[model samples]
Target: MAAALAVTGCTSQSSGPSKVSSSSGGPAPGDSRTPPHSAPPRSPSTSAATSGKTPGGGSASGAGRTPSSRPPGQGAGFPHCSPGTLSASLRQLEAAAGNRYAALVLTNTSDRPCRTQGWPGLQLTSEGGGRIPTETARDRAHEAQPITLKPDDRAWSRLHWTVVSSSGDAADGSCPTPGALRIIPPDERHSLGTGWDLGTVCGKGRIQATALSTGEGPAH
Candidate 1:
């Protein structure tokens, strides 16, 4: 009886160890099968560079780049010539029918082309920087024409005034002599002029102006 009991006990102990070993080798309940691998987030600049884009939203074909300047008459959108971009001068062209005639010439000094249009705003000023009141006489027969001037090219307008009276005459009276002419380009508020000696007249419309043209005009 004692021998039979020992064999049973040995069988049970061997079976118990095998079962424990098998259970230990496997994953436990509620345990994950493998650890997950996470990646880092990418930055916006890095993403844009890889996609052939600039941080400023520019593309590979130069889109969003600074636009080059355009010439006049290519479109109405072309900018007009500001006084800063021009050099101006006046020359008496002739005297006709008891009136003095002169050409106000403007030369484009910029590298780009510019438009000269409409009538130039005109005024007379003293050498002391005081505004001289004068009347503007528009040439009714003259037309407002737009002219395009390329670099170093020129445009001109005509001005006519009555001969200065010496008597300070009461009927065609005399006024303060002007030291300069104030010229404002068409559609602009800025002015340009140099020393001028247009003797003053008492009446309105003493001086008349024509619109800008390709050359000096009696035919604007």
Candidate 2:
């Protein structure tokens, strides 16, 4: 009878330890089962890698995408007008005093709309494409404003120059005639060429220009 009691006591002690260990609610060192509510925290890198996304909310694949080259205030729908997409023309105005005047017209030849602003670069060239002496001065009396142009639409800039020679010009008041005029749009390196039929600009090839405006310039 004592032997049986000893066996029972040993079994109860061993079983109690097993029950206490199981109720501890912790994973054993070599236990294959994960403890309840003890999931590993997700790391940012792991999450990003799994979702194929960057921390900036952009796709990982788009991280290397090129940015838009359009200038500020210019919408994606209408880019700034480039010289290659424009055609240049000239309108001779009535001569006044010793100064001659004309309007430089720029027409959008592209199918899409474009924007333009500020003064355009002007140059005079010979018939053989040789560069001629030219000087352009901007008239800031009128402020420059962005002008949007649709296909076939136009923008104009006023040009004024003296036909009479200044002290800085030749002694005979004679000036070289330009066969072609090169018009470069603002912020562009390319130019559009147009014929120059107006007579000589006598003030050392100097001409005054205004910022581009909407529609055609003054008629007279």
Candidate 3:
């Protein structure tokens, strides 16, 4: 009986060890739970890294797009002329049949070369700096050409008006004499002023002007 009891106690102790070993061999609940939680953080970080590259690629593509238009004279390696770098003068031409004519001359006073094209803006003012009623009409018969003016080079425009009064003139059949002439370069805002002694401009102060051309105007 003593030997049998000792054998039975040894069997119970062995069974307890086997149960403990089996439970430990299987995956721990903490290990499974840790992997699932840690795995979610890695997935979000990977997606964030991928999304960050998309905007950088989009910006690179946008930088390759072309502009719709370029500024004038940009292709010629020269800049547009400004009023500050120019000097203006008037050359009176011969008068015929109640018509008067003159040449508006512009000289490049700057050392650098500049380009200009199109019609210029003109206005007449009284001696007291008062605005006069002047109408400038373009002569489309002449096409504007781009002119490159070197230092001290010149460009000119023809100006023609009537000295005699027309039906549009005031009832007195008279016109106001301009004391100053304001000349604005093409594509410029500021103006250059010169003295004007031309007696009177008729037909409601209308003046016909031509596009600028290279060199001094014809004396005739």
Candidate 4:
């Protein structure tokens, strides 16, 4: 009886250890079924369409726009004549006592009508391309008149100078002869180069001029 009890005890002990080892050594059947890997959620910037905007977060259409054409005759409101649109000519007129006079004529060459007013800025240049000093004077005789020129309309100004001094001595600067006149229209920046050969320009401020007019005739 003692031998049989020992054998039974040993068998129960051996079977207990076998069952525990089998259960702990390997994974369960349900655990072997792995959960699928899921990707991370995307940011708002990554999905531009969902945010109702372009990738740059602005409107895509009409990216670059330009201005439309300007209205007609808008530039004609203050149409002042430029030097390029007029022809300048000069001629000797008369001599009284010691003073000499000449006419500077400007003719419209453009198709449209333009206007000019005030005295012209004049400077005498030599044949070798040297600028001779001169001073301009306002003429109370001829008032400032806005001369409007059509396609072929013309205007004129009288330039006067004193070749002799008050004491009857020759004026300073050796009285150089002028080859060409550089004329600047009123309120204009550009100057017109016109041929001019009067006689001689003397000291500073000796030259004077009357404002342009439509009534002034060409110097004969």
Q: Best candidate per lDDT, number? A: 2
Off by over 4 Å in 4: 1-78, 165-173, 215-219
Candidates in order, TM-scores: namely 0.58, 0.65, 0.64, 0.59
Q: Candidate 4, residues 127-170: lDDT per residue as tens digits? A: 76566655555564845654555556677778888776443334
Q: Which prediction has more favorable TM-score, 2 or 4?
A: 2
Model 4: how far is 105 from its true place, Å? 0.4
Q: Is candidate 3 or candidate 4 better by lDDT?
A: 3
lDDT digits (tens) for residues 104-173 of candidate 2? 9888777766666667767777777676766666776686765567677788889888888788777876
Worst 10 residues of 3 by lDDT: 1-10
Q: Candidates ranked by TM-score, best first?
A: 2, 3, 4, 1
Cα TM-score of candidate 4: 0.59
Poorly placed runs, candidate 3 (over 4 Å): 1-75
| Candidate 1 structure quality by residue, lDDT tens digits, 71-107 | 3233243356777787778787757665777888877
Steric clash pairs (candidate 3): none
**Deviation (Å) of 176 in candidate 2:** 1.1
lDDT of each: 0.52, 0.62, 0.61, 0.54
